[model samples]
Target: MHENVRTLLDTLELEKLEENLFRGTSPDNGWQRVFGGQVVAQALVAAQNTVAQDRHVHSLHGYFIRPGDPTIPIVYEVARLRDGGSFTTRVVTGIQHGEAIFTLSASFQRPEKGLEHQATMPKVPGPDDIIGQEELTTRILESAPDAVRHYWMRPRPIEFRPVSFEHYLTGDKLPPAQNVWVRCLSDIGDDPKLNAAVLAYLSDMTLLDTSLFAHGMSIFDRRVQAASLDHAMWFHRPFRVSEWLLYTQDSPSSSGGRGLTRGSLFSADGTLVASVAQEGLIRLRQKSQPDV
Candidate 1:
């Protein structure tokens, strides 16, 4: 297994500190702050630990209250909101420095028959057809800015194969949409809860960047101050993170210093397995005082 993937799995395996409390740490990857997805995944894991094994998470909503300090361990406190006949609800708060940095509300449901319907998966080329991140970096990073180049060169647990590279290459302000193939670098097992946690982690990778597509900008751009404000996900079917999934994303609107983006995850066989939505801060700084 890839070392990065191993690290991610270990990170998600939160240590139990009390009956309804858990602790998790972020990898020392030299980032200024902890990634939002990591907190979301850890919160999910914390919630899952307190729930019945028979139930699986169907939906989760989370808010980013403050930037997480990666240098310290985050303590997750889980609150058992309700345990009903068919549904169980849990609320998790991630604390650091005695303050809440993140909060998540997840609902788990026991398997049962229900109406089946989903939006049609968009027709797109397979993962094998799209160029992987490595090739994209080797081909384009030489002339890219330091920030952009550094971001692409870093090792990650999840791999991305975007269907189109024009935005990154030419900086054309095109449509606010894109399709990228994503998968874990190694097998994360078949446990539904584990897979769901990993899926939640991967969901935050590039969804917010879709909002910048129309402006021919990216979160890596130094002029843009970007951060996820809130995230929500709904799992429609069982999925394995190790397998390839097409992440179709679009930004329906951007205004008032915020952008709203939506995404759908489809299995290799075109099964709609999950959906995600996020709103992020996209404040652009003036060029004169770039450091501010």
Candidate 2:
């Protein structure tokens, strides 16, 4: 495993506190707020740890209640909502400093054959045709804003190979759409729940950015204040993090300071593995008055 992925797996291995509680800590990456993805993934891990191994996560609905504090540890409390012959449900609440910071409800199911169908994957350049992470980061940083560059240069559990960097390369107010090829930098063994948690982590990576494409802005844009409000995901088929997956995303609407975006993940062989949707608060900041 790559050092970064190893660090992430270590972060996900929550420490059991009570029968239904676990504690998780963040790596000292120097961010004031914890990455939303990490908390989602860790909460999923905590919930799965409390359930039978035969069940695999099929869907999750989550809400980000408050910004997480990276310097402090988070406590995840899991409640068993239901247990059926084939399906199980769990609700996980992430608490920090005695307040709820995030929450998720995940439903799991045993393996069973079923009729399946999916939309055809969009035709796009494959991973081999895209610029690798090191080169892409170097290219973008030449003119990227401080926040964007900082995020790109940092060592992450996965590497993003965007289909195109046109929007960032130039401040173009293009359509609200994006395509990026992504995968974990390394393997974390063959634990199915682990894979699901990792997927949950990745699902939050760029959905908000896509929502900003139409407005010609980004999370890096100092004039914009953006944060996820809620996130939802559904697992349709088995997937692996060690292999490339295409994340095709687009924003259908952005108005009233809230934007909604959706995406689908397809394996290299064109099987749709999962789907994700999120809405975020994307308020434009009022420009500061010029100093007198």
Candidate 3:
């Protein structure tokens, strides 16, 4: 396992507080708190720890409280909500500083035959044809707004390859639609569930940025303030996230200082493995003028 993946697995091994209660430590990072997806994915893992192996999580809904404290350990309290013949449900509350930092309700279902249909993946260049997000970030920071560049051009977990090299760092503020091909940086084994969870973690990283595109604002711009509020995801098919997955995202509406974004994750061969939706706080911050 990669070091980061190992850190994640260790964090999910919640310390037993009491029967059905546990506490999880935050990874040692400099973020204001735990990354939103980390808590969501970990909570789901914790919930799954108590269930049968045959059951796989198919859906999840989560809300972020105060940003999590990476310096502090999170306490997770699991509720055995329902256990039936073919379906199981669990609710996990992540607590830090005696307050609920995050909470998730996840549902798992055993494999079953069902009707199947999925929207075809959009036509896009293959991964090898596009530049990675890190490389693009470095290239764009040369002329980008300093504030935006300094904040967004930092290191990250996974590498992203947009189908076409356009609008990423150009400060062009293009349309609200974005199709990026992404995959893990390290060989993260062949486990489908782990891949799904990793995808879930990455999905929360940038969906909101799509909502800001049409407004002529970049996430790097000082006048823009964006953060995810609620996130929900649906698993559509079984696939490995270690390989290429197309994340097509769009913003349907933005108003009242908020925006809603939706996206679907598809395998390189056009299998829609997951769908995601999220709403975020899109309030603009006070502008800081650039040096003349």
Candidate 4:
């Protein structure tokens, strides 16, 4: 595993507290607040620990109530909502400073045969055909805003390669859709819970930004304020984190200072492994600063 991925795995392995409580800490990634995906993934891990071993996470819904303090530990308290023969539900609240900063509800299911069908994967160039970060950075610098360029080029555990790079340049309103290829920097093994947790971690990478594409804006725009409000995901099939997955995303609406975006993850062979939906705070700052 990459050094960062190893760190991430350790971060996910929350410290057990009381029977129903766990504690998690943020990695020193130098961000002001904890990453939304990290909290979501950690909360899911907390929920998974309380669930039966035979059950696998099938869906999760979460809301970001407050910004996380990366400097301190987050306490996750799990509530066993319901446990049935085939499904188990858990509600997790990530607490910091004795207040609720994040909350989630996850459902797990036992293995069972069922009819299945999914939308066909869109036609796009494979990951190998796309220009990755190193090559793209050289080109992005010439046209992208300084802050936007830097944010997009910076190192991250997940490699996010957008098929359409125009949105990061000028604010020429384009379609509210994009396709990106994403995967872990190194293999994190085949543990099912770990695979699901890693997928949850990556799901929050860029959905909200895609919502701003039609308005010629980006989360990096200082004039525009943005934060994820809620996130929802459904795991349709099992998949490995080491392999490339295509994240196809689109924004269906943006109004009342919020933007809604949905994304689908497809394996190399085109099997839709997961679906995600999120809404974010995307209002413009009153006294506009640099939009970079």
Prediction-by-prediction clash tally: 0, 0, 2, 0
Q: What is the Å distance of residue 97 in model 3 from its true position?
A: 1.3
Error in Å for residue 37 of model 1: 0.6
Which tens-of-lDDT digit does each residue in 1-292 have in candidate 1?
9999999999998999999999999999999999999999999999999999999999999999999999999999999999999999999999999999999999999999999988988999999986777777778777887876777678989998888866665567889999999999998789999999999999999889989989988887767889999999999998898999999999999998899999999999989999999999988886553321
User: What are the runs in model 3 whose C-alpha is more than 4 Å off?
Assistant: 133-138, 147-153, 164-173, 286-292
Measured with C-alpha atoms, the lDDT of residue 29 in candidate 2 is 87
Q: Which pairs of residues have clashing backbones in candidate 3?
A: 33-68, 148-220
lDDT of candidates 1 onward, in order: 0.92, 0.89, 0.79, 0.92
Model 2: residues with Cα > 4 Å off, grouped in runs: 287-292
How do these models rank on lDDT, best leading?
1, 4, 2, 3
Residue 108, model 1, lDDT: 97
Clashing residue pairs, candidate 4?
none
Give the TM-scores of the predictions, in the order they appear: 0.96, 0.96, 0.89, 0.96
Model 2, range 214-237, lDDT digits (tens) per residue?
877777887888889999999999
lDDT (0-100) at residue 167 of candidate 3?
51
